[model samples]
Target chain A: AQSVTQLDSHVSVSEGTPVLLRCNYSSSYSPSLFWYVQHPNKGLQLLLKYTSAATLVKGINGFEAEFKKSETSFHLTKPSAHMSDAAEYFCVVILSGSARQLTFGSGTQLTVLP
Target chain B: GAGVSQSPRYKVAKRGQDVALRCDPISGHVSLFWYQQALGQGPEFLTYFQNEAQLDKSGLPSDRFFAERPEGSVSTLKIQRTQQEDSAVYLCASSNRDRGDHQPQHFGDGTRLSIL
Candidate 1:
């Protein structure tokens, strides 16, 4: 079974400051990792995906994540935080054999202060 | 529609009542999925469908929960004898199977079910 753990349940950052949300995964085989964001009363929006192509994956809204195989981590990062970045972020994994279902982390709520 | 569309954005039902949620995936999408998101938690997989075939349903919580994609374009999730524990946001997503598994699934706004 594959699973993901989000290190922080909540993260707060001031505007123009760097933001980091940690995530770790346990999988038997190579995993497809993704980051998704959801605002209140809205749908989950894909931020970025890492499919073994590049270790450093860039996503929309100036977000990016680095897939570190040795560290067993896929941490999301942003150079600067904006007020609109306040939302719930999730780390998801797809196992090698079963690509149908997505295993999601508990989630990390980001709060951006002005 | 332009994206995945779910009906009855908000539903309030008494306990023991039966409720059904609908999902219309993007046209030509070969894969559809259902997930349950409880308050303060990430969404959990409930079921999956490939075209019109119901391939995997290992995530269904109970026998009372059922989902079907009769024609492959639209899907429905029905819950019988609803319990308070079943109250959550039901999300529907679809992806192009031919595009490979790495493709991100597009999600709907979700149907919030409140059981009383």
Candidate 2:
């Protein structure tokens, strides 16, 4: 029953401003977490992943996330927002054990205004 | 062939009609997966395949939904007697590692299915 909760359903930011999309996960054990972005009519793209190697994980396109065990959070952050960053973001967790299934949160739609 | 490729970018079918969606995973990838994404929602796992053997299909919604990957390469998801509820984007993904590995799954532009 591992799952992720996206705190915001929609987040709007002006261009060049910082971006934050909150995600909290529920897992019985140490989990594998990932952030994916989907553009209009495009496939889901992997932005980054956390596999316990490091608490702070960096992803493509100047994006990064921190895996905070104490807070049960894996929030995605970026120093600045770009118009191209407008899309739907999903926080995902890999099912524990051999199932390897992915449990996704109810996604957050990011709108970057220029 | 650079990434996972799905056929029929869009599909429109009448209620009770049957539709088949295809997925071609990355070459040499040992694992393949199928997912269903409703409008304004995240993608949900529908099934998994390990080299043509369907190891986990627990996420499939019902018996009317079926998937196959013969020879461990291209996979297909078939929906019989499609209902309006079944209208959604069917996504296909592939990974180049074994089960339990942390290798990220690469996704294909999903096939959007609409049932009237």
Candidate 3:
């Protein structure tokens, strides 16, 4: 079975500070990884994805993630956090041979301080 | 529609009542999926369909949960005799291509189902 674990349940950052949300995945085969962001009462929005082509994947809103096979990790990072960046982040994994099923992690809520 | 669309953004049903949630995927999308998201938890895969054919439904919790896509464009997830545990947000998503191509799935604003 494949799954993703988010290390933090909540992370608070000051405006303009760097932000990091950790995620670790377990997969038997090569997997497709993705990052999604959700605002209150809103649908999830795709942030970035790693499909084995690029180790470093850049996404919308100045966010990026690095996929490390050896580490089995795909952590999301932003150099500078803005007020609008406050939302929930989910680390998702699409294991090979699952017929396009997505396993999502318990989200990490981000809080940006002014 | 420009994106996936879900109907009845909010629904309230009594326990033992049957409820149906609708999902309209992006036009021409070949694959559609249904997911269940509990409060404070991540969304879990419930079922999948490929062009009107239900390819995978192993994630459905029980027989009370049913989903269908007749023409491969509009899909519906029906829950019979809903229980309190079944009270969660039902999400629908669609992808441009099949599973092997690794296309990203677009999500809809989920239908929030509350069972009283």
Model 3 chain B scores worst on lDDT over the 10 consecutive residues at B96-105
Tell me the DockQ of each model, to 2 decimals: 0.70, 0.82, 0.76
Mark the 10 consecutive residues where model 2 chain A has the least summed lDDT: A95-104
Clash count for each candidate, listed in order shown: 0, 0, 0
User: Weakest 10 consecutive residues, lDDT, candidate 1 chain B?
Assistant: B96-105
Off by over 4 Å in 2: none
Task: State the lDDT of candidate 3 residue by residue for B1-116, as single tens digits.
Answer: 89999998999999999999999999999999999999999999999999999999989999999999999899999999999999999999999887736688999999999999
Tell me how candidate 2 scores on lDDT: 0.95
Q: Residue A27, candidate 2: how far off, in angstroms?
A: 1.0
Over A1-114, each residue of candidate 1 has an lDDT whose tens digit, in order, gives 889999999999999999999999998777899999999999999999999999999999999999999999999999999999999999999855443578889999999999
TM-score of chain B of each: 0.97, 0.98, 0.98
Instruction: Spell out the clash pairs found in candidate 3.
Output: none
- Evaluation by DockQ, superior candidate among 2 and 3: 2
lDDT for each candidate structure: 0.93, 0.95, 0.93
lDDT of 2 by residue, B16-72 (tens): 999999999999999998999999999999999999899999999999999999889
lDDT per residue (tens digit) for residues A20-88 in model 3 = 999999988778899999898788899999988999999999999999999999999999999999999
Better of 1 and 2 by lDDT: 2
In candidate 1, how many Å is residue A18 off?
A: 0.4
Top model number, lDDT: 2
